[model samples]
Target: AASLLGAPIGHDLCIISLSDLMTPWERIEKRIRAAAIGDFVTAVYNPKSEGRYWQLYRLKELFLEERSPGTPVGYVRQAGREEQVVNLTTLAEFDPEQVDMFTVILIGNSQSYEAGGKFITPRGYYGEIKMKTDVGIGQDIMIRSFRTIEKELKDKEMPLDKKWALLHAIHTTADFDMENILRIDDHAVASLYEKFNRGEVRTIITDVTMAASGIRKGALQRMGIEVKCYLQDERTIQLATEKGITRTQAGIRLAVQEHPGALYAFGNAPTALIELCDLIRKGKATPAGIIAAPVGFVHVQESKHMVKPFVSIPKLIIEGRKGGSNLAATLVNAILCYNDAEQLKPGRDV
Candidate 1:
């Protein structure tokens, strides 16, 4: 079965039912020792339950005699279901109580490590090449960013129109460094807008400070939206313009140096954003896809784990590790399913 499924030779299968309800402990122990001597990759079934728990520990000891502690161990709890939790840990950390009748454990032949806190079991590419797996990392970062925004926006749900207009005005004003509003609130609004426009947000809100400059009024006017502001301050407007240039210049630098995959910018940071945009438009970067967070950016191309071919606007404005992880997992699942279905279909030959 392993060979037919493209698994390598010398791959022997060992199954041990950890449940003591039917199978005696003596029989289970004997099978464990035999499989260890046989050097077979073992799959455990019925590893834990309310009544039985020590089997998992005993099996670990049995395998430890023959196998190195660094062996790759995979845990699939409730596999192929909505409540599925799959992870690869080391044999040393393997716990029997973590699994029940619904769990399946696969332990490999001594090659696993914790990289950046993730358990990685390499197949053939251990020393071959550096993996283009930064997408996964970037996705992780994006998820963190999204959670921040989601928490901030949790309470304000209805009347999205007010949220939308205010958010837009706030973002525009903030970019211009407009004053009269608290700096912290401006930062929040700035961050919120940046996050929202990245294609993730459906709505947002802003605070209005009248007698502040007509910046919001002017912006609303240009956008054909009506809004009234009290207490317009010319002094604040003057200072905002001076500070805005400095902010824009800083953004341009960070976007260029910090973001590896950013090919373009679409907002007020014109000199920098426009340059990047032009490069992207001209096909120089040939970006696999675009990911926008509140202030984070990354580019990705399709690879084994990520099977989606590069497309325009793969995901917009959604940020953080959770979003990226979900996207990557979805893409991989879709590709694998499609490939399997294609193989099973009738041949084209007449």
Candidate 2:
């Protein structure tokens, strides 16, 4: 049975027959108490019958004293037979009436979880691929979307990082033509992941409040980072008014001054992108990376084109003036997701 179940039963466990006809009830109780106190995953055979019913309830009571109510419980009746019934439940929901002489009950320790309709006791490989295969709805959607994007780009020849960026651009815009307009340096995508993982990029400066708000705050908090948008700052407003420049441009200049080597994400104002490009050209600011996706008819294309000359730093640009805060935020999140070192293994599907 252990071999058939793929070694789930190989862990420290004790099996006891609940038939009290030959074994005295006192001795059975002692064995149950020992199993419960020792924290052993237990299997009970012949759990109940017509006359022997209260023993299963007694076993539950004894186990409850030591185990949590959420401990997993699995039941199998008529194993290997035609009329077999297998169930996965919890200790709090265990029904003694469901068991009989033909049933085998396997109760789990503190580490088990219900996954894909089965009880899984994690055997210390929580970060392995086997444990990650079953994900929740949000992750499942992202994986499926990536798969679809991969299938659509099967004929294209590009590196995995670039492909990942392109796929995310397409995913954000729902436009297959985005692959043509997306601009990413050869090593920029990889450098972005490295900077993010190494904590080199600690602050994310955005042009607009929408872009700043769209970034996942929880994800940034987990990485010990902060997002900033200085467009509404009083100093920025005063500086912009005094210099006769847009508030976003002044904010970008101020942000670069305050947080050097910060990630710059521009989604709204082309002036902000233009200011960032000017800062880079003048050596006044050294940004970790730039996400330039300003949506406008005026100078959006021109501003993005301006940033093209500076090739020393990482940049993710959505060309042709077809971008907004949502697209910019999506691109940032895509980079964040890719920064997960464990998920970016050599042969990983995503």
Candidate 3:
């Protein structure tokens, strides 16, 4: 029903049965919240019945929490049957009085729209891009930017995941030089993604709060990955004084002591990266992977050079003085979406 109604078949979709017969209401509501927050095309089965009319209203309320009132939604009654009936409406205008258990509701994602009475969700199959004034303006702009990056990218021959990561970096900075500077070890993204999925690595230690803040919180929460920054921790302040070290260095030490196997990402602090390297050499830390991209003239180049010897650990490096919190966060985003590399469908969860 969703595909027929013009939901983007190429993008992520969430199918939900709102019947609380065997499933607890809370659990079903949890799924609804996830779908809404993730901005996925949602197809709802068993939306209403004699005893379930209120549930559908609650679901609408949940969707409205994330989506605009004008978001497109469609429904089909007895779809594909002799008495098939389909209707298109905005989310605010979708009337539950007309729906029942036999009806299937299709609520478009943030990018969905109503055109020529057909419900539509656009998920970036970009030969040309058009901006629509709708609930998904931000995503539309991002999709346009991604297509622009694709057209302007210098190296189209790189591996899919690496190229995907580069796209993210270029998107973040608008710096085409990322093609020349960004480096990914063989299968680095895949390895880290596996560890994340297997629950072997659940934490990411960033050198600063800015780096931590830039990471996509929606994906991190869904994957149950914890991002921790110790720079602002009082314990880190105390430790810095005790060790006579820079706050960033102390933060890394404290982070390593707590999560020795977590992925460590460096953005603003070269000293922190240097300190992590020192810890790894001295058997104090065993990070799952390292993102070595600290932007500075002071020890930044040296810090990246220091991390190169640890061939056993996976890595993504941005060479030279071009790195930031956004860059590190976007690289993390790339690995998390590595499974989507071949498909070129980034940002399933915004």
Candidate 1 lDDT, 1-350, residue by residue in tens: 22212223343556777886877889889999988766566777778887787778888998877664545577677777788877666676677667777887765543333444344333343235433332344333332332223223323332322223222222323321111211111122233333333533321111122111212332223233222221133433444466663333333333334333422212122233333344455554432222221122333111111212233423222222212222222221121122122111111110
Supply candidate 1's per-residue lDDT for 122: 30
lDDT of 2 by residue, 95-210 (tens): 98888889888887654545556666534333343334456546545544654454455334466577777777777778887787788888777788778878878889999999
TM-score for all models, in order of appearance: 0.31, 0.59, 0.63
Alpha carbon lDDT at 147, candidate 1: 25
In candidate 1, what residue range of length 10 has the lowest lDDT sum? Answer: 341-350
Candidate that beats the other on TM-score, 1 or 2, i.e. the better one: 2
Best by lDDT: 3
- Give the CA lDDT, 0 to 100, for residue 14 in model 2: 81
What is the alpha-carbon lDDT of model 1 when measured against the actual structure? Answer: 0.39
- Model 3 alpha-carbon drift over 4 Å, by segment: 1-135
**Ranked by lDDT, top first:** 3, 2, 1
